[model samples]
Target: MIQVDRLTKRYGSFKAVDGITFSVGRGEIVGLLGPNGAGKTTTMRVLTTFLGPTSGRATLAGHDVLDEPLEVRRRVGYLPENVPLYLEMRVREYLLYRAKLKDVPRSRRRAAIHEVITRCRLGDVEDRILGHLSKGFRQRVGLAEAMVHDPDILILDEPTAGLDPIQIREVRALIRELGDRHTILLSTHIMSEVEAVCGRVIIIAKGKIAVDDRLDRLRSESSIVLEARGPADAIRRGLESVPGVEHVVQAKVEGDYAAFEIHTKNGSDLREELAQRVLQNGWPLRQLDIRRTTLEDRFIQAVTRETISAEAEREAV
Candidate 1:
Protein backbone atom coordinates (compact mmCIF):
# COMPACT_ATOMS: atom_id res chain seq x y z
CA MET A 1 0.00 0.00 0.00
CA ILE A 2 3.14 2.22 0.15
CA GLN A 3 5.64 2.75 -2.66
CA VAL A 4 8.84 4.78 -2.74
CA ASP A 5 10.94 4.73 -5.86
CA ARG A 6 14.37 6.35 -6.09
CA LEU A 7 13.40 8.96 -3.50
CA THR A 8 16.05 11.59 -2.75
CA LYS A 9 16.15 14.60 -0.48
CA ARG A 10 18.82 17.28 -0.13
CA TYR A 11 19.33 20.28 2.16
CA GLY A 12 21.54 22.91 0.52
CA SER A 13 24.73 20.97 -0.26
CA PHE A 14 24.00 17.95 1.92
CA LYS A 15 22.11 14.88 0.76
CA ALA A 16 19.88 13.76 3.60
CA VAL A 17 18.24 10.87 1.75
CA ASP A 18 19.68 9.56 -1.52
CA GLY A 19 17.84 7.40 -3.97
CA ILE A 20 16.12 5.02 -1.55
CA THR A 21 13.53 2.61 -2.92
CA PHE A 22 11.18 0.15 -1.22
CA SER A 23 7.53 -0.80 -0.84
CA VAL A 24 5.20 -2.10 1.85
CA GLY A 25 2.11 -4.16 1.10
CA ARG A 26 -1.28 -3.89 2.76
CA GLY A 27 -1.37 -5.04 6.40
CA GLU A 28 2.44 -5.39 6.38
CA ILE A 29 4.65 -3.96 9.11
CA VAL A 30 7.94 -2.68 7.64
CA GLY A 31 10.69 -1.34 9.89
CA LEU A 32 13.08 1.46 8.96
CA LEU A 33 16.29 0.92 10.96
CA GLY A 34 19.52 2.88 11.04
CA PRO A 35 21.86 4.82 13.31
CA ASN A 36 21.33 8.49 14.06
CA GLY A 37 21.64 10.84 11.03
CA ALA A 38 20.81 7.99 8.68
CA GLY A 39 17.96 9.89 6.94
CA LYS A 40 15.15 7.68 8.23
CA THR A 41 13.10 10.70 9.28
CA THR A 42 13.69 12.35 5.93
CA THR A 43 12.29 9.36 4.10
CA MET A 44 9.24 9.29 6.35
CA ARG A 45 8.53 12.97 5.79
CA VAL A 46 8.76 12.56 2.03
CA LEU A 47 6.40 9.59 2.07
CA THR A 48 4.00 11.44 4.32
CA THR A 49 3.99 14.43 1.93
CA PHE A 50 5.18 16.71 4.76
CA LEU A 51 8.21 17.44 2.59
CA GLY A 52 8.71 17.17 -1.17
CA PRO A 53 11.39 14.87 -2.51
CA THR A 54 14.21 16.41 -4.54
CA SER A 55 13.72 13.68 -7.13
CA GLY A 56 11.84 10.40 -7.74
CA ARG A 57 8.32 9.54 -6.67
CA ALA A 58 6.13 7.86 -4.05
CA THR A 59 2.50 6.90 -3.75
CA LEU A 60 0.18 5.85 -0.96
CA ALA A 61 -2.67 3.54 -1.91
CA GLY A 62 -2.61 4.68 -5.57
CA HIS A 63 -2.45 8.37 -4.64
CA ASP A 64 0.66 10.26 -5.76
CA VAL A 65 2.32 11.78 -2.70
CA LEU A 66 3.47 14.88 -4.61
CA ASP A 67 0.69 15.51 -7.08
CA GLU A 68 -2.12 14.23 -4.87
CA PRO A 69 -0.71 14.99 -1.44
CA LEU A 70 -4.05 15.77 0.15
CA GLU A 71 -5.33 12.33 -0.80
CA VAL A 72 -2.13 10.69 0.53
CA ARG A 73 -2.43 12.62 3.80
CA ARG A 74 -6.03 11.57 4.07
CA ARG A 75 -5.03 7.88 4.05
CA VAL A 76 -1.76 8.05 6.00
CA GLY A 77 -1.33 8.77 9.72
CA TYR A 78 2.06 10.14 10.75
CA LEU A 79 3.54 10.41 14.25
CA PRO A 80 6.67 12.49 14.07
CA GLU A 81 9.50 12.22 16.61
CA ASN A 82 8.63 15.43 18.46
CA VAL A 83 4.87 14.77 18.36
CA PRO A 84 3.67 18.41 17.97
CA LEU A 85 1.36 18.40 20.98
CA TYR A 86 -0.84 21.23 22.22
CA LEU A 87 -0.34 21.40 25.97
CA GLU A 88 -3.32 23.65 26.71
CA MET A 89 -5.89 21.16 25.45
CA ARG A 90 -7.30 18.14 27.23
CA VAL A 91 -6.50 14.75 25.75
CA ARG A 92 -9.93 14.21 24.24
CA GLU A 93 -10.28 17.84 23.19
CA TYR A 94 -6.97 17.84 21.32
CA LEU A 95 -7.90 14.63 19.52
CA LEU A 96 -11.28 16.04 18.56
CA TYR A 97 -9.66 19.11 17.07
CA ARG A 98 -7.26 16.99 15.00
CA ALA A 99 -10.11 14.74 13.92
CA LYS A 100 -11.98 17.76 12.66
CA LEU A 101 -8.90 19.04 10.83
CA LYS A 102 -8.44 15.66 9.15
CA ASP A 103 -11.93 16.19 7.67
CA VAL A 104 -13.71 13.63 9.80
CA PRO A 105 -17.42 14.20 9.36
CA ARG A 106 -19.14 16.02 12.24
CA SER A 107 -21.14 12.88 12.85
CA ARG A 108 -17.99 10.75 13.27
CA ARG A 109 -15.73 13.09 15.28
CA ARG A 110 -16.90 11.87 18.69
CA ALA A 111 -16.64 8.23 17.67
CA ALA A 112 -13.20 8.86 16.14
CA ILE A 113 -12.00 10.60 19.30
CA HIS A 114 -13.27 7.80 21.53
CA GLU A 115 -11.88 5.08 19.28
CA VAL A 116 -8.31 6.44 19.33
CA ILE A 117 -8.47 7.14 23.05
CA THR A 118 -9.44 3.54 23.68
CA ARG A 119 -7.06 2.07 21.11
CA CYS A 120 -4.10 4.12 22.35
CA ARG A 121 -4.80 3.46 26.04
CA LEU A 122 -5.85 7.02 26.87
CA GLY A 123 -9.12 5.97 28.52
CA ASP A 124 -8.19 6.84 32.10
CA VAL A 125 -6.74 10.20 31.12
CA GLU A 126 -9.05 11.13 28.28
CA ASP A 127 -10.36 13.98 30.36
CA ARG A 128 -6.92 14.95 31.75
CA ILE A 129 -5.14 17.99 30.38
CA LEU A 130 -2.34 16.90 28.01
CA GLY A 131 0.28 19.03 29.71
CA HIS A 132 -0.27 17.30 33.05
CA LEU A 133 0.19 13.80 31.70
CA SER A 134 3.40 11.77 32.02
CA LYS A 135 5.88 11.52 29.17
CA GLY A 136 4.55 8.05 28.32
CA PHE A 137 0.99 9.23 28.25
CA ARG A 138 1.94 12.24 26.18
CA GLN A 139 3.56 10.00 23.59
CA ARG A 140 0.40 7.90 23.38
CA VAL A 141 -1.63 11.07 23.18
CA GLY A 142 0.47 12.04 20.18
CA LEU A 143 -0.20 8.66 18.65
CA ALA A 144 -3.90 9.04 19.39
CA GLU A 145 -4.02 12.38 17.64
CA ALA A 146 -2.25 10.88 14.65
CA MET A 147 -4.87 8.14 14.41
CA VAL A 148 -7.85 10.30 15.24
CA HIS A 149 -8.94 10.23 11.60
CA ASP A 150 -8.61 6.45 11.37
CA PRO A 151 -6.26 6.41 8.39
CA ASP A 152 -5.45 3.17 6.60
CA ILE A 153 -1.69 3.49 7.14
CA LEU A 154 0.41 4.60 10.16
CA ILE A 155 3.99 5.86 9.98
CA LEU A 156 5.52 6.18 13.45
CA ASP A 157 8.92 7.80 13.97
CA GLU A 158 10.33 6.58 17.28
CA PRO A 159 6.91 6.28 18.92
CA THR A 160 8.40 4.80 22.09
CA ALA A 161 11.17 7.29 22.71
CA GLY A 162 11.81 8.48 26.28
CA LEU A 163 9.39 5.94 27.72
CA ASP A 164 10.06 3.36 30.45
CA PRO A 165 10.31 -0.38 29.79
CA ILE A 166 6.69 -0.88 30.76
CA GLN A 167 5.59 1.90 28.43
CA ILE A 168 7.68 0.48 25.62
CA ARG A 169 5.94 -2.88 25.90
CA GLU A 170 2.58 -1.17 25.99
CA VAL A 171 3.38 0.81 22.86
CA ARG A 172 4.59 -2.34 21.10
CA ALA A 173 1.39 -4.19 21.89
CA LEU A 174 -0.63 -1.27 20.56
CA ILE A 175 1.40 -1.17 17.34
CA ARG A 176 0.88 -4.90 16.79
CA GLU A 177 -2.83 -4.52 17.41
CA LEU A 178 -3.01 -1.67 14.92
CA GLY A 179 -1.08 -3.62 12.27
CA ASP A 180 -3.86 -6.20 12.04
CA ARG A 181 -6.00 -3.63 10.24
CA HIS A 182 -3.57 -1.06 8.84
CA THR A 183 -0.32 -1.02 6.93
CA ILE A 184 2.43 0.11 9.30
CA LEU A 185 5.80 1.72 8.75
CA LEU A 186 7.80 1.49 12.01
CA SER A 187 10.98 3.57 12.33
CA THR A 188 13.10 3.00 15.42
CA HIS A 189 16.68 2.44 16.58
CA ILE A 190 15.53 0.09 19.34
CA MET A 191 16.30 -3.38 17.99
CA SER A 192 14.16 -5.14 20.60
CA GLU A 193 11.11 -3.13 19.64
CA VAL A 194 11.63 -3.98 15.98
CA GLU A 195 12.21 -7.60 16.91
CA ALA A 196 9.07 -7.65 18.96
CA VAL A 197 6.69 -6.22 16.34
CA CYS A 198 8.12 -5.86 12.83
CA GLY A 199 7.67 -8.55 10.18
CA ARG A 200 10.17 -7.12 7.65
CA VAL A 201 13.03 -4.64 8.02
CA ILE A 202 14.44 -1.95 5.73
CA ILE A 203 17.81 -0.71 6.96
CA ILE A 204 18.95 2.69 5.72
CA ALA A 205 22.52 4.01 5.92
CA LYS A 206 24.27 7.00 4.32
CA GLY A 207 20.95 7.84 2.68
CA LYS A 208 20.67 4.46 0.99
CA ILE A 209 18.86 1.18 1.47
CA ALA A 210 20.97 -1.50 3.16
CA VAL A 211 18.78 -4.60 3.63
CA ASP A 212 15.08 -5.27 3.17
CA ASP A 213 13.80 -8.72 4.12
CA ARG A 214 11.68 -10.65 6.56
CA LEU A 215 13.10 -11.06 10.10
CA ASP A 216 13.04 -14.84 10.08
CA ARG A 217 14.48 -15.09 6.56
CA LEU A 218 17.37 -12.73 7.33
CA ARG A 219 18.57 -14.81 10.31
CA SER A 220 17.96 -18.14 8.61
CA GLU A 221 20.00 -17.11 5.57
CA SER A 222 23.01 -15.57 7.26
CA SER A 223 24.45 -17.46 10.30
CA ILE A 224 22.75 -20.05 12.45
CA VAL A 225 24.35 -20.45 15.93
CA LEU A 226 24.14 -23.96 17.33
CA GLU A 227 24.56 -24.70 21.04
CA ALA A 228 25.35 -28.31 21.97
CA ARG A 229 25.92 -29.93 25.34
CA GLY A 230 27.78 -33.22 25.85
CA PRO A 231 31.16 -34.60 26.88
CA ALA A 232 33.62 -31.78 26.31
CA ASP A 233 36.53 -33.80 25.01
CA ALA A 234 34.46 -36.23 22.99
CA ILE A 235 32.13 -33.55 21.57
CA ARG A 236 35.06 -31.39 20.63
CA ARG A 237 36.91 -34.29 19.02
CA GLY A 238 33.86 -35.50 17.15
CA LEU A 239 32.70 -32.08 15.93
CA GLU A 240 36.04 -31.48 14.26
CA SER A 241 35.38 -34.51 12.04
CA VAL A 242 31.91 -33.26 11.04
CA PRO A 243 32.21 -31.59 7.66
CA GLY A 244 30.93 -28.00 7.25
CA VAL A 245 31.63 -27.15 10.93
CA GLU A 246 33.94 -24.17 10.53
CA HIS A 247 34.60 -23.09 14.12
CA VAL A 248 33.81 -24.71 17.48
CA VAL A 249 34.25 -23.17 20.91
CA GLN A 250 33.79 -24.84 24.31
CA ALA A 251 31.69 -22.36 26.28
CA LYS A 252 32.14 -22.03 30.02
CA VAL A 253 29.22 -23.44 32.03
CA GLU A 254 28.41 -23.62 35.74
CA GLY A 255 28.14 -27.41 36.06
CA ASP A 256 30.47 -30.19 34.87
CA TYR A 257 28.49 -30.45 31.65
CA ALA A 258 30.23 -29.00 28.61
CA ALA A 259 28.55 -26.55 26.18
CA PHE A 260 29.84 -25.59 22.78
CA GLU A 261 28.69 -23.64 19.71
CA ILE A 262 29.19 -24.91 16.18
CA HIS A 263 29.71 -22.15 13.66
CA THR A 264 29.11 -23.63 10.23
CA LYS A 265 29.50 -22.45 6.68
CA ASN A 266 26.74 -20.29 5.29
CA GLY A 267 23.54 -22.17 4.29
CA SER A 268 24.68 -25.30 6.11
CA ASP A 269 22.53 -27.48 8.36
CA LEU A 270 24.52 -29.66 10.78
CA ARG A 271 21.84 -30.62 13.30
CA GLU A 272 21.14 -34.12 12.05
CA GLU A 273 24.80 -35.06 11.74
CA LEU A 274 25.63 -33.72 15.19
CA ALA A 275 22.65 -35.50 16.68
CA GLN A 276 23.78 -38.78 15.19
CA ARG A 277 27.31 -38.24 16.48
CA VAL A 278 26.03 -37.59 20.01
CA LEU A 279 24.02 -40.82 19.87
CA GLN A 280 26.92 -42.79 18.43
CA ASN A 281 29.23 -41.68 21.23
CA GLY A 282 26.57 -42.59 23.84
CA TRP A 283 26.97 -39.07 25.26
CA PRO A 284 24.07 -37.42 27.10
CA LEU A 285 22.97 -34.51 25.00
CA ARG A 286 21.70 -31.63 27.08
CA GLN A 287 20.76 -29.14 24.40
CA LEU A 288 20.98 -28.94 20.63
CA ASP A 289 19.44 -26.11 18.64
CA ILE A 290 20.43 -23.76 15.85
CA ARG A 291 20.51 -20.36 17.52
CA ARG A 292 20.35 -17.52 15.07
CA THR A 293 22.04 -14.18 15.62
CA THR A 294 19.99 -11.41 17.15
CA LEU A 295 18.65 -8.53 15.08
CA GLU A 296 21.25 -6.27 16.69
CA ASP A 297 24.06 -8.37 15.22
CA ARG A 298 22.35 -8.44 11.84
CA PHE A 299 21.86 -4.67 11.87
CA ILE A 300 25.47 -4.04 12.82
CA GLN A 301 26.72 -6.47 10.22
CA ALA A 302 24.63 -4.87 7.47
CA VAL A 303 25.65 -1.28 8.26
CA THR A 304 29.30 -2.11 8.83
CA ARG A 305 29.55 -4.19 5.71
CA GLU A 306 28.09 -1.40 3.60
CA THR A 307 30.48 1.17 5.12
CA ILE A 308 33.53 -0.96 4.44
CA SER A 309 32.36 -1.77 0.94
CA ALA A 310 31.87 1.91 0.18
CA GLU A 311 35.33 2.70 1.52
CA ALA A 312 36.85 -0.05 -0.60
CA GLU A 313 35.15 1.32 -3.73
CA ARG A 314 36.44 4.82 -2.99
CA GLU A 315 39.95 3.51 -2.41
CA ALA A 316 39.85 1.55 -5.65
CA VAL A 317 39.20 4.80 -7.51
Candidate 2:
Protein backbone atom coordinates (compact mmCIF):
# COMPACT_ATOMS: atom_id res chain seq x y z
CA MET A 1 0.00 0.00 0.00
CA ILE A 2 1.15 3.53 -0.87
CA GLN A 3 -0.31 7.01 -0.49
CA VAL A 4 0.91 10.35 -1.76
CA ASP A 5 -0.95 13.56 -0.94
CA ARG A 6 -0.23 16.82 -2.71
CA LEU A 7 3.37 15.81 -3.17
CA THR A 8 5.57 18.55 -4.62
CA LYS A 9 9.21 18.54 -5.55
CA ARG A 10 11.24 21.40 -6.97
CA TYR A 11 14.72 22.18 -8.25
CA GLY A 12 15.01 25.87 -7.42
CA SER A 13 12.20 27.54 -9.41
CA PHE A 14 11.42 24.53 -11.62
CA LYS A 15 8.81 22.22 -10.15
CA ALA A 16 9.44 18.65 -11.19
CA VAL A 17 6.42 17.27 -9.36
CA ASP A 18 3.53 19.56 -8.53
CA GLY A 19 0.84 18.78 -6.01
CA ILE A 20 0.18 15.23 -7.28
CA THR A 21 -1.95 12.86 -5.21
CA PHE A 22 -2.72 9.18 -5.69
CA SER A 23 -2.68 5.84 -3.93
CA VAL A 24 -1.85 2.24 -4.80
CA GLY A 25 -3.80 -0.46 -2.99
CA ARG A 26 -2.38 -3.74 -1.82
CA GLY A 27 -1.46 -6.12 -4.66
CA GLU A 28 -2.42 -3.57 -7.30
CA ILE A 29 -0.29 -3.07 -10.39
CA VAL A 30 -0.69 0.57 -11.45
CA GLY A 31 0.93 2.07 -14.49
CA LEU A 32 2.39 5.62 -14.23
CA LEU A 33 2.45 7.13 -17.72
CA GLY A 34 3.71 10.44 -19.08
CA PRO A 35 5.67 12.11 -21.84
CA ASN A 36 9.36 12.96 -21.37
CA GLY A 37 10.20 15.19 -18.35
CA ALA A 38 6.71 14.89 -16.88
CA GLY A 39 7.96 14.22 -13.32
CA LYS A 40 7.24 10.51 -13.19
CA THR A 41 10.77 9.71 -12.01
CA THR A 42 10.63 12.59 -9.56
CA THR A 43 7.42 11.29 -8.04
CA MET A 44 8.81 7.78 -7.77
CA ARG A 45 11.98 9.05 -6.19
CA VAL A 46 10.03 10.93 -3.56
CA LEU A 47 7.87 7.87 -2.86
CA THR A 48 10.88 5.55 -2.61
CA THR A 49 12.73 7.90 -0.23
CA PHE A 50 15.46 8.42 -2.77
CA LEU A 51 14.53 12.10 -2.84
CA GLY A 52 12.70 14.12 -0.22
CA PRO A 53 9.66 16.05 -1.36
CA THR A 54 9.83 19.82 -1.17
CA SER A 55 6.34 19.78 0.29
CA GLY A 56 3.43 17.42 0.94
CA ARG A 57 3.62 13.91 2.33
CA ALA A 58 3.88 10.28 1.19
CA THR A 59 3.79 6.95 2.98
CA LEU A 60 4.63 3.35 2.21
CA ALA A 61 2.64 0.74 4.13
CA GLY A 62 1.77 3.39 6.75
CA HIS A 63 5.38 4.57 7.15
CA ASP A 64 6.04 8.20 6.31
CA VAL A 65 8.47 8.50 3.44
CA LEU A 66 10.22 11.51 4.95
CA ASP A 67 10.13 10.72 8.66
CA GLU A 68 10.53 6.96 8.35
CA PRO A 69 12.61 6.75 5.22
CA LEU A 70 14.49 3.72 6.49
CA GLU A 71 11.25 1.87 7.08
CA VAL A 72 9.92 2.91 3.69
CA ARG A 73 13.12 1.89 1.99
CA ARG A 74 12.94 -1.48 3.65
CA ARG A 75 9.53 -2.10 2.12
CA VAL A 76 10.08 -0.57 -1.31
CA GLY A 77 12.26 -2.05 -4.04
CA TYR A 78 13.20 0.45 -6.76
CA LEU A 79 14.51 -0.19 -10.25
CA PRO A 80 15.26 3.20 -11.76
CA GLU A 81 15.12 3.97 -15.50
CA ASN A 82 18.86 3.64 -15.68
CA VAL A 83 19.32 0.64 -13.44
CA PRO A 84 22.37 0.87 -11.18
CA LEU A 85 24.27 -2.39 -11.32
CA TYR A 86 27.75 -3.60 -10.55
CA LEU A 87 28.95 -4.73 -13.95
CA GLU A 88 31.87 -6.76 -12.65
CA MET A 89 29.81 -8.85 -10.29
CA ARG A 90 28.21 -12.11 -11.33
CA VAL A 91 24.41 -12.25 -11.43
CA ARG A 92 24.10 -14.43 -8.34
CA GLU A 93 26.91 -12.61 -6.63
CA TYR A 94 25.33 -9.25 -7.38
CA LEU A 95 21.95 -10.28 -6.02
CA LEU A 96 23.54 -11.90 -3.03
CA TYR A 97 25.44 -8.73 -2.28
CA ARG A 98 22.29 -6.66 -2.62
CA ALA A 99 20.40 -9.05 -0.37
CA LYS A 100 23.02 -8.59 2.28
CA LEU A 101 22.88 -4.84 1.81
CA LYS A 102 19.12 -4.99 2.37
CA ASP A 103 19.90 -6.74 5.67
CA VAL A 104 18.76 -10.18 4.63
CA PRO A 105 20.22 -12.54 7.25
CA ARG A 106 23.26 -14.45 6.06
CA SER A 107 21.28 -17.67 6.48
CA ARG A 108 18.51 -16.39 4.15
CA ARG A 109 20.56 -14.40 1.68
CA ARG A 110 21.50 -17.41 -0.47
CA ALA A 111 17.93 -18.66 -0.73
CA ALA A 112 16.58 -15.16 -1.38
CA ILE A 113 19.06 -14.64 -4.18
CA HIS A 114 18.08 -17.96 -5.78
CA GLU A 115 14.38 -17.25 -5.54
CA VAL A 116 14.70 -13.89 -7.34
CA ILE A 117 17.01 -15.47 -9.87
CA THR A 118 14.36 -18.02 -10.78
CA ARG A 119 11.54 -15.50 -10.64
CA CYS A 120 13.47 -13.08 -12.88
CA ARG A 121 14.51 -15.93 -15.22
CA LEU A 122 18.20 -15.30 -14.56
CA GLY A 123 19.04 -18.83 -13.58
CA ASP A 124 21.02 -19.83 -16.68
CA VAL A 125 23.15 -16.72 -16.43
CA GLU A 126 23.29 -16.64 -12.66
CA ASP A 127 26.95 -17.55 -12.69
CA ARG A 128 27.86 -15.31 -15.60
CA ILE A 129 29.40 -11.87 -15.06
CA LEU A 130 26.91 -9.03 -15.28
CA GLY A 131 29.25 -7.19 -17.66
CA HIS A 132 29.16 -10.11 -20.10
CA LEU A 133 25.36 -10.39 -20.06
CA SER A 134 23.15 -9.07 -22.87
CA LYS A 135 21.06 -5.97 -22.28
CA GLY A 136 17.96 -8.12 -21.76
CA PHE A 137 19.75 -10.40 -19.33
CA ARG A 138 21.25 -7.38 -17.60
CA GLN A 139 17.79 -5.93 -17.19
CA ARG A 140 16.70 -9.17 -15.58
CA VAL A 141 19.71 -9.02 -13.32
CA GLY A 142 18.66 -5.52 -12.27
CA LEU A 143 15.17 -6.80 -11.51
CA ALA A 144 16.56 -9.70 -9.55
CA GLU A 145 18.58 -7.24 -7.51
CA ALA A 146 15.49 -5.16 -6.83
CA MET A 147 13.52 -8.14 -5.52
CA VAL A 148 16.37 -9.80 -3.68
CA HIS A 149 15.13 -8.38 -0.40
CA ASP A 150 11.51 -9.47 -0.94
CA PRO A 151 10.14 -5.95 -0.49
CA ASP A 152 6.41 -5.41 -0.22
CA ILE A 153 6.37 -2.70 -2.94
CA LEU A 154 8.12 -2.67 -6.30
CA ILE A 155 8.79 0.61 -8.08
CA LEU A 156 10.02 -0.11 -11.58
CA ASP A 157 10.82 2.73 -13.98
CA GLU A 158 10.93 1.61 -17.60
CA PRO A 159 11.42 -2.02 -16.70
CA THR A 160 11.37 -3.02 -20.34
CA ALA A 161 13.33 -0.12 -21.74
CA GLY A 162 16.01 -0.84 -24.35
CA LEU A 163 15.01 -4.48 -24.63
CA ASP A 164 14.14 -6.61 -27.65
CA PRO A 165 10.50 -7.51 -28.28
CA ILE A 166 10.89 -11.00 -26.83
CA GLN A 167 12.70 -9.62 -23.80
CA ILE A 168 10.00 -7.02 -23.32
CA ARG A 169 7.40 -9.80 -23.27
CA GLU A 170 9.44 -11.67 -20.72
CA VAL A 171 9.71 -8.65 -18.43
CA ARG A 172 5.98 -7.97 -18.79
CA ALA A 173 5.09 -11.53 -17.80
CA LEU A 174 7.41 -11.25 -14.83
CA ILE A 175 5.78 -7.96 -13.73
CA ARG A 176 2.31 -9.53 -13.98
CA GLU A 177 3.37 -12.52 -11.89
CA LEU A 178 4.94 -10.22 -9.31
CA GLY A 179 1.73 -8.21 -9.06
CA ASP A 180 -0.01 -11.23 -7.59
CA ARG A 181 1.95 -10.64 -4.38
CA HIS A 182 3.54 -7.15 -4.46
CA THR A 183 2.14 -3.69 -5.05
CA ILE A 184 3.77 -2.45 -8.25
CA LEU A 185 4.10 1.12 -9.56
CA LEU A 186 5.79 1.18 -12.94
CA SER A 187 6.42 4.16 -15.26
CA THR A 188 6.57 3.50 -18.98
CA HIS A 189 6.13 5.27 -22.30
CA ILE A 190 4.71 2.07 -23.80
CA MET A 191 0.91 2.13 -23.87
CA SER A 192 0.49 -1.52 -24.85
CA GLU A 193 2.46 -2.59 -21.81
CA VAL A 194 0.07 -0.70 -19.53
CA GLU A 195 -2.98 -2.10 -21.35
CA ALA A 196 -1.58 -5.61 -21.13
CA VAL A 197 -0.26 -5.59 -17.56
CA CYS A 198 -1.82 -2.77 -15.53
CA GLY A 199 -5.30 -2.75 -14.00
CA ARG A 200 -5.32 1.04 -13.57
CA VAL A 201 -3.34 3.85 -15.15
CA ILE A 202 -2.20 7.24 -13.82
CA ILE A 203 -1.41 9.58 -16.69
CA ILE A 204 0.90 12.37 -15.51
CA ALA A 205 1.55 15.44 -17.63
CA LYS A 206 3.10 18.85 -16.89
CA GLY A 207 3.90 17.72 -13.35
CA LYS A 208 0.31 16.77 -12.55
CA ILE A 209 -2.02 13.79 -12.68
CA ALA A 210 -4.15 14.00 -15.80
CA VAL A 211 -6.25 10.85 -15.46
CA ASP A 212 -6.49 7.97 -13.05
CA ASP A 213 -8.94 5.11 -13.60
CA ARG A 214 -9.37 1.44 -14.37
CA LEU A 215 -8.08 0.30 -17.77
CA ASP A 216 -11.32 -1.38 -18.82
CA ARG A 217 -13.40 1.63 -17.79
CA LEU A 218 -11.13 3.99 -19.70
CA ARG A 219 -11.34 1.81 -22.82
CA SER A 220 -15.13 1.94 -22.64
CA GLU A 221 -14.96 5.76 -22.52
CA SER A 222 -14.74 6.08 -26.29
CA SER A 223 -16.89 7.65 -28.95
CA ILE A 224 -19.61 5.88 -30.93
CA VAL A 225 -18.51 5.35 -34.54
CA LEU A 226 -21.36 5.60 -37.00
CA GLU A 227 -21.39 5.21 -40.77
CA ALA A 228 -24.60 5.95 -42.59
CA ARG A 229 -25.71 6.50 -46.19
CA GLY A 230 -27.35 9.92 -45.83
CA PRO A 231 -26.71 13.61 -46.17
CA ALA A 232 -23.73 14.55 -43.99
CA ASP A 233 -25.37 17.62 -42.46
CA ALA A 234 -28.61 15.77 -41.85
CA ILE A 235 -26.81 12.85 -40.20
CA ARG A 236 -24.78 15.23 -38.03
CA ARG A 237 -27.93 17.10 -37.02
CA GLY A 238 -29.78 13.89 -36.16
CA LEU A 239 -26.85 12.63 -34.06
CA GLU A 240 -26.48 15.97 -32.26
CA SER A 241 -30.17 15.95 -31.41
CA VAL A 242 -29.90 12.53 -29.79
CA PRO A 243 -29.91 12.62 -25.99
CA GLY A 244 -26.58 11.75 -24.28
CA VAL A 245 -24.70 12.77 -27.41
CA GLU A 246 -22.35 15.62 -26.61
CA HIS A 247 -20.69 16.27 -29.96
CA VAL A 248 -20.68 14.57 -33.34
CA VAL A 249 -17.27 15.05 -34.95
CA GLN A 250 -17.25 14.14 -38.59
CA ALA A 251 -14.73 11.58 -39.86
CA LYS A 252 -15.24 11.51 -43.62
CA VAL A 253 -17.78 11.00 -46.39
CA GLU A 254 -17.72 8.80 -49.50
CA GLY A 255 -20.52 9.26 -51.99
CA ASP A 256 -23.81 9.11 -50.08
CA TYR A 257 -22.27 7.55 -46.94
CA ALA A 258 -20.55 9.55 -44.25
CA ALA A 259 -18.67 8.33 -41.18
CA PHE A 260 -19.06 10.29 -37.91
CA GLU A 261 -17.88 9.76 -34.36
CA ILE A 262 -20.47 10.65 -31.74
CA HIS A 263 -18.95 11.72 -28.44
CA THR A 264 -21.34 10.79 -25.68
CA LYS A 265 -21.57 11.57 -21.99
CA ASN A 266 -19.34 9.30 -19.94
CA GLY A 267 -19.06 6.78 -22.77
CA SER A 268 -22.81 6.31 -22.82
CA ASP A 269 -24.19 4.01 -25.51
CA LEU A 270 -26.66 5.82 -27.84
CA ARG A 271 -26.90 3.09 -30.45
CA GLU A 272 -30.61 2.38 -29.86
CA GLU A 273 -31.59 6.03 -30.18
CA LEU A 274 -29.29 6.39 -33.17
CA ALA A 275 -30.81 3.35 -34.85
CA GLN A 276 -34.32 4.59 -34.23
CA ARG A 277 -33.48 8.00 -35.65
CA VAL A 278 -31.90 6.47 -38.78
CA LEU A 279 -34.86 4.16 -39.28
CA GLN A 280 -37.37 6.96 -38.82
CA ASN A 281 -35.54 9.13 -41.34
CA GLY A 282 -35.21 6.18 -43.79
CA TRP A 283 -31.44 6.61 -43.67
CA PRO A 284 -29.39 3.55 -44.64
CA LEU A 285 -27.23 2.64 -41.65
CA ARG A 286 -24.09 1.01 -42.95
CA GLN A 287 -22.22 0.52 -39.66
CA LEU A 288 -22.77 1.41 -36.03
CA ASP A 289 -20.28 0.49 -33.30
CA ILE A 290 -18.47 1.89 -30.30
CA ARG A 291 -14.91 2.85 -31.01
CA ARG A 292 -12.67 1.18 -28.41
CA THR A 293 -10.33 3.63 -26.70
CA THR A 294 -6.76 2.46 -26.36
CA LEU A 295 -4.20 3.56 -23.80
CA GLU A 296 -2.55 5.78 -26.39
CA ASP A 297 -5.86 7.49 -27.06
CA ARG A 298 -6.40 8.25 -23.38
CA PHE A 299 -2.82 9.44 -22.92
CA ILE A 300 -2.90 11.80 -25.89
CA GLN A 301 -6.32 13.16 -24.94
CA ALA A 302 -5.26 13.86 -21.37
CA VAL A 303 -1.96 15.50 -22.31
CA THR A 304 -3.48 17.55 -25.12
CA ARG A 305 -6.42 18.64 -22.99
CA GLU A 306 -4.17 19.55 -20.10
CA THR A 307 -1.88 21.56 -22.38
CA ILE A 308 -4.85 23.52 -23.74
CA SER A 309 -6.17 24.17 -20.25
CA ALA A 310 -2.78 25.40 -19.05
CA GLU A 311 -2.52 27.68 -22.08
CA ALA A 312 -5.96 29.15 -21.37
CA GLU A 313 -5.07 29.68 -17.72
CA ARG A 314 -1.92 31.57 -18.69
CA GLU A 315 -3.91 33.73 -21.08
CA ALA A 316 -6.45 34.48 -18.33
CA VAL A 317 -3.65 35.44 -15.96
Number of clashes found in candidate 1: 1
Tens-digit lDDT string for candidate 2 (1-97): 9999999999998889989999999999999999988899899989988899999999999999989999998899999988888899888888877
Scored by lDDT, the top model is: 2
State the weakest 10-residue window (summed lDDT) of model 1. 222-231
Cα TM-score of candidate 2: 0.90
Compare the candidates by TM-score and give the number of the best one.
2
Models 1 onward score TM values of: 0.81, 0.90
Q: Could you list the CA RMSD of all candidates, in the order they appear?
A: 5.4, 2.4
